[model samples]
Target: MISSANILFEFICFVMALCFLKGNDKFTLFTKLYLGLVCITETSGFLWMMCTNKSNIWIFNIYILFEALYISFGLYHFIKPFKKNVKPLYIATYLIFIAVYLYGSFTRGFFKFQTTAIMVASVLIVFLCLYYYHNLMKSDKIISIRNNLGFWWVAAVLFFYFGSTVYNLFMNVIFSNKPFAYEILVYIMLTLNAILYGIWSYSFICSSRHQKLLTSSY
Candidate 1:
């Protein structure tokens, strides 16, 4: 039987492919790219884990690296169309995260150090998201698109990502020695991730539909 992680990884990849194929607009295109990269990296990690009999620490390490890169790219695309000045800061931050992950992976045990880094990173990301939203609101740039879908989508992503991050940290720190418990929680987290991705995909569709309607009315 295929592992749960493998199954979910395949499903995510399939969904990402469909999103890419159907995406015609720039917004959808960026979303497709972001999700596609995430799915690819995750699937690769899972495959590596299975092939190596779940003993290869490097797979998870590389997975975290890809994840950090994905977030960096997603944030870049998210702010690029509206606020170009933030691009350099985002790039710098991305490089810092890559360096940190590489250092931790090579010097420390992959899962343990990766978990610690992710927990810290998640908190920082949440703060950044809040800052972005606050600035947009203050500038009176919180128009219909920003109000209706953009803010909510960002919130959803942050919520789910952080939620999963917290669970991962807990599994690593609290249940590290309990293999069965750790495995169960990991599966649960994977399911949550799938649900989060589904919600994100739905939000993308809604945003696309809204734009199409506005275009038609013009």
Candidate 2:
């Protein structure tokens, strides 16, 4: 039930991104593509599970690689307007994450989740989101917070990733507790996904409204 709701949330967010964010700019286009990939990857995971009756970890393993890259780039896109010299920071983080992820994949095999790599990526993302907030607060652009698409989008990412930090860090311990802990984690994931996609949908709407205002002013 909860899993289905998360899937529904994913689809809804993807549709919203398509309708509101498509073709606006390079970042928006990349966002649209990323959301599309999310939908496809999710659907493929379910189908793979149904057919093989086995773990589809490999699908998500590959997905996370792109997820990290796209999200890092998205943060960089938003942050570059304020800080010109941040490219190396973003690039270096990606390099570290890719190396960690590859090591996890090779050592544990693709069938296992790369928990360490995920933790690293999630922690880094949370920090980047904080950095974004820090810059936004210090900038003269404070008045645009209400309809700032990038702000809202990054907020959603922060909430989702930060909220999942506990689960990501304690996956083995949680699973070791058997059905109860597992069920708890499932609910946690459902809530996290809701927060993520819910805010993403709203951010798309905000972007649409902002664009309309700009168009009308001309």
TM-score of each: 0.75, 0.95
Give candidate 2 regions above 4 Å deviation: none
Q: How accurate is candidate 2 locally (lDDT)?
A: 0.87
lDDT on C-alpha atoms for all candidate structures: 0.61, 0.87
How do the residues 1-218 of candidate 2 rate in per-residue lDDT, one tens digit apiece?
A: 66467679999999999888844578988888898898899888888988999988889999998999998998999899989999998998799899999898889888888898999999999999999889988988644766678989999999999999888977867766655678888788889988998998998898888888888999
Residue-level lDDT of model 1, residues 1-218, one tens digit each, is: 33455456546644744642344655556556656666666667667777776654565566666566566555555665467687786777666676666677777756554765666556656655665676666664546654244555666667766677658567665555767677667667767666666656555565656667677999
In model 2, where is the ten-residue run with the lowest total lDDT? 172-181
RMSD of each candidate relative to the true structure: 3.7, 1.4
Error of 1 at 22 (Å): 6.4
Candidate 1: 10-residue stretch with minimal lDDT: 16-25
Task: Name the lDDT of candidate 1.
Answer: 0.61
